[model samples]
Target chain A: MTSSSVPKRSRSAMDASAAATQALYGASDPGLRIRSIVFRSALLLSMTVALIAIIGIISWAVVEGGQRLSLGLLTNNPSSFRPETAGYRPAILGSFQIIAGVIALIIPLGVGAALYLEQFANKQRWYNRAIELNIQNLAGVPSIVFGILGLAFIVRGPLDMGFIAAAGSATIALLVLPTVILASREAIKAVPPSLLEGAMALGVTRWQAVWKMVLPAAAPGMLTGIILAVARAIGEAAPLLLVGAATFVTFDPNFWEGGYSALPVMIYQYAGRPQDEFHVLAAAGVLVMLGLVVVVNSVAVWLRAKYERTW
Target chain B: MKELGKEKLMAESASTKEEVFSLDGVNVYYGDSLAVKDVSFPIYKNEITSLIGPSGCGKSTILRSLNRMNDLIPGARVEGDLQYHGADIYGSDIDPVQVRKIIGMVFQKPNPFPKSIYENVAFGPQTLGMKGNLDDIVEEALVGAALWDEVKDRLKDNAFGMSGGQQQRLCIARTIAVKPDVILMDEPCSALDPVSTYKIEDLMMKLKEDYTIVIVTHNMQQAARVADKTAFFTVSSNDEEGSRTGVLVEFDETGKIFSNPADQRTQDYVTGRFG
Candidate 1:
């Protein structure tokens, strides 16, 4: 309606209408504000709790073992009677050797399994579904159960490789294989289906498309997964203990047929002893293990940042 | 509607042009349900044939089936005669890979590999073992797509760094690097802006000199601008069975399909009366 054709209201009525409109678009109720604040605080509190636990553990290790952190910790060999001069030379070498083996075993096996499942397997088949279900379940199985299997299969029965660094590597690799496969599958799945179709439309066979385009696109993520899985394998002590990461070894580990000691197994042995000095040595071992894991995880983060694709 | 389309096709068959693809009573199915029913048409050599329709009318399905891209989806099946150069593409002995090598596709979205622009173009020729200087092939394909000048200095850069239109053109470059006879594009310009769309339409016009193109598009004006022939599809739903099937209402020269359509549905669609 035109302005001149409309009736004009009194000043009091106009004032009342203006006030109603103002109130209609005014600030939200106090209940909503309080609820929003509570939700945000809860989220912050959850993050704080996780951060505190990690920081607390790192600080505790530093306080308990800072005095023992020296060049001697890396150079000298372990001594049972003399904890003062003892170091993690053999244990450090042993951890590296087993990890190398684990990398060799897991890269081909884990990536191969993930590729088979993600790219080739028909989801309509019952067995492929069963295999996927089993791999997921395997990731959740206790690490000690893997130790038992390793003892029965690799160390003593069937393959009979004996208690050496190779056996320890095989056991830890088996324990982390499920994690690697799951992560690799996620990375492969993250590559767009359109990319595959684009490649196929160009006349490449399925394998060539996967090997050339799909794998390179998925490499950074797969590498990140491998590094994370290796980190988890590094800190595992229970399975290695059963697979024979010995309590004490003076010399460097032989990959094939000699005694070896991983950092975590040595730490566990030291913590079980009666001396306070040995407990400090155990804490020092924890520091070394934590450093290795942090370095590996940093590599993963850098690779992801460098190569992740937006489209 | 079906009879009118057939009559038009019969009249067009009097021409001496070679047919690259000939479909008769083609029916596409996903599982037991028919998705597109009785699609009959001829795609001639070096011609741009556009499929135009509203949503859920199986336009993309028909385009994808031309290159056997629908085989990638589980339970998707095609029936009736679909011949590529007088041979049944679906014959038991014909390898789908071989069929795809002859018929390449461009998708609705630009899906370049997460690699350098040079690598993206080089991948197809390298995989197919095409004998040539690799650099020259990539440069030629980029030139053919009208992208070489903008990207030649930055061939080593990642394909993802380009603009949307540039990336789509790079996808076109990658497809043509394989040297396929037919290129099937599924709504290639729907994801682009107006300028990019027209650029692609212009590219399509130039490309028709070398390649037989069958494009599915929601833009009717695009068909009018670049297409030599047009096929109009509409959805026919059965309320009792709760099913919708795509039916070809008309097929003719691009001029007649847009200006003087035979079927009422085609007339209404071209005039924007209703989808």
Candidate 2:
């Protein structure tokens, strides 16, 4: 019996050593220590790189544009020859109009689509699945593709609206609709099914239940989606170019007609110009665009916090 | 009016109470699979009927069917007659929403709207256009659910601020706000602590004096304590392909079902021999 127990005693001793090792380094294998350190360092390095890039861009824009940023930049109109005198007045107004139009278009349409897909559609049906898959794919498609579609359809084809600010708004709205829908659908799905059931049990119609309970529960998340979409819409230059966003405009744009210049389009034109003053102007425009996006996102975050529901 | 009320109560006690619901050969199916098979029973007005069974026995399914709650589930269909006041609930002209207005339900988990306590109780009445002094109606409903005393001071607070049991009672108050004739509870106390469960049990006993109550519970003791009648359900599985169906084995007055059950399965279940 002593001989038999000797090997068992050694095995237990080995287990104790393994336990000691795990307690020290979180793993039994000593080699895993180096591996875990290396893995952790790599992950940290990757995140640091992203953080550095964002900070560098913001700093560079502020430093480059700080001197040129002024009330004049906000008040004057774009001029190719007189870069110092030029401002983004028309572009600012036009961009605001486009954003407003995009919001008006996307909120109802995207939320409606999300509600129908998440709450009403029969998911087992092939067509519904196809529609869902297509929406996801559409969100990933290049914004330029949407611009082309808007140009061909809204500006030139059956609808035959002109190359107007509203046309650009339509294009951007179409570009971001998938993003809004996907996000809104996720928000709607996050609502506990119990809330809907409780409301329905009270004899309310299905629409009433969704309208009263699900929508309120989902409003915060939906607002976040809209804000992100708006940020994406405001920064897009290529799409607006395709939809005829004018590179140069001295006058404020009418909504449905006339030439319009957006901040991104103006920045693109200014940055391409062969002059130091124009380059500074481009940086200033970029800073303004970034500021607007930050403001919109801040508002979204505030709204989410204000309406956060625990359940 | 007080004398008239007493006289009516005496008459109602002397005569057999009216049946609120009578099920005849009911089989509930989700898509092609049967969940509950051949359930037949009568639920009398102003009495508590508890459906008790082991897991997967479809007690909740039978309770939900009474108020057409199963209609919310896609591909769920019920065959055979489930009558409310002698009218078939499955008839072509019968609206599920209208049916729900008369027969309210509480779920296993308490689900109050993320609104104020006042709003949570007021929602159903507001939506259904229940005309009265709104505050009075809310207070009366809360009082009836035995929650007014605890919640009256914090009526404007968020419903989620309440403890679990209070939230459950708030749900009960919300249901009563609409003045439903019958209330279906599916394991309302399962999520509560023992003390909270006792409180809800006491509340349900009081509720049965006004509204007919049907409860589905896993706790046999709970059924014995608060139920006037008991239905024991058990899972019946077919050997071929391992399909399971919930079958009602026995149903009787609570006393007889607990003390001297007619079926062997009921005796086994009640005596703790086997589920």
Candidate 3:
């Protein structure tokens, strides 16, 4: 640790090496420059590959379905006898109702669970760890598995609310609940410890500190999570199938009382039909779903940019 | 000259001896491992007492225990008497939330809420349900922290907009807004530049006129410059566990501790020979 033991010539030794390197190559090393160029191009190539795939899919959907996408697509319900006039109006309304219900149910429950785990739970305890691990594992389970569970419990057995949009909503809510909880916990955990300590030092109770400081600090992240979960819920057709999302509902959906067909379920029904017109209609439904997903994700990004705390 | 130094020390010590906090045989632990063992000291009313030491010395840990902030950490426990106003802070009847209000804390880094400067200060008083002209309270606390002149023009601006020094002062303003009796500062200047550190040091001197302050600092010069009394801590090796525990090496008037420390460890640390 002494200066005497660290020879003064060590600096000169480093300088000499630097001078020798500079002499060998005047300003820059050609090998390093070539390596940097190669690395940069590799990264650029990877990005282009992903961009090409997305652009390819979107262009194909637009070209194939653009003719069928009209105002009538938004207003007219599906008709079995009239192939040209059949539309996804009921399916769109059904998707919205189901997503709205899912959002309403998930936000409070997911955020509450996250707050408990991050701010209140004693993480060292085995039960809390068990809950944490199970939530993570549940997020990875297939959506159709949730659908089966929903059919057994929600559609027929315990709750027994059969074939209603609310039942389908409940099923999707269960399917995405784990995703919301995991994302929310990450968001809540992102809040700085100093903010909590600052509030506590002001004589604010623990709950007050979390509510007033932590939750607000974490709001932008939670919003992003909710948006992503809703996106996933709207796109899932497999779960809706078992949870009683009817394939050919003609009426405008009622969430609490009637049969419903979501956009994906309608698309599925159309795609499986052995007719050229129905396939075009299915592509048009995909276009609508894609637009909705993009709009939701864009709103998430905007909300995050607006409300994100620098600290 | 020596006699003058001794007489001055005696006068300062005697005049400020009205005790605010008294600790006897205090031992702190995290889980089963000891952090600081058997620390005893008396902090006086309206005087600045500093805890100074190297890293892992538990000076900050002891400072936190005074306000029961240690309870926030899992498996952290405090043993022995840590008395605030003659009441055991660890007693069942005492609430940590209430105790925190009486003894406020400022952390090592400036951590302002992601709010306007005015709201940051107002938040504390609002939580306590103090009935008053909130505007006046906010203004008074900001002025007391010496930040009103700079931020008075933009009370509505987000606190993140301020410089690091201003932000730290805002934290002080926020702490004072609740009208706490004592303030605990944990390395308030470690993240600040020299000028900001000097300004904060000056503010602490002015603040001690109204509230008792206990600060933990790694910068020894800061301790010598602003603290009236200084307690030096050092890490002692625990042979059995191969762990180092913080132990109080010396406590005395800052001038005396710097010039004529009673313990060799304290002298070595202060003189920069060893820690």
Residue A73 alpha-carbon offset, candidate 1, angstroms: 1.3
Itemize residue pairs with steric clashes in candidate 1. none
Error of 3 at B68 (Å): 1.2
DockQ (Cα-based) for each candidate: 0.69, 0.71, 0.66
Order the numbered candidates by DockQ, best leading: 2, 1, 3
Over 4 Å off in model 2, which ranges? A1-29, B1-14
> B174 in model 1: Cα distance from truth in Å?
1.8
Which docking class does model 2 fall in?
A: medium
TM of each candidate vs. truth: 0.91, 0.93, 0.91
In angstroms, how far off is B265's CA in candidate 3? 1.1
Ten-residue region with minimum lDDT total, candidate 1 chain B: B1-10
Superposed model 1: Cα runs more than 4 Å off: A1-24, B1-15
- lDDT score, candidate 2, position B223: 97
DockQ: which is higher, 1 or 3?
A: 1
What residue pairs clash in candidate 2, if any at all? none
Model 3 lDDT per residue over A1-311, tens place: 76567677986787798999999878796899999999999999999999999999888889888889898987898987676899999999999999999999999999999999999999999999999999999999998899999899999999999988898989999989999999899998888899999999988999999999999889889999999999988899999999878558999989888789899999999888888898888888889999999999899889988887656
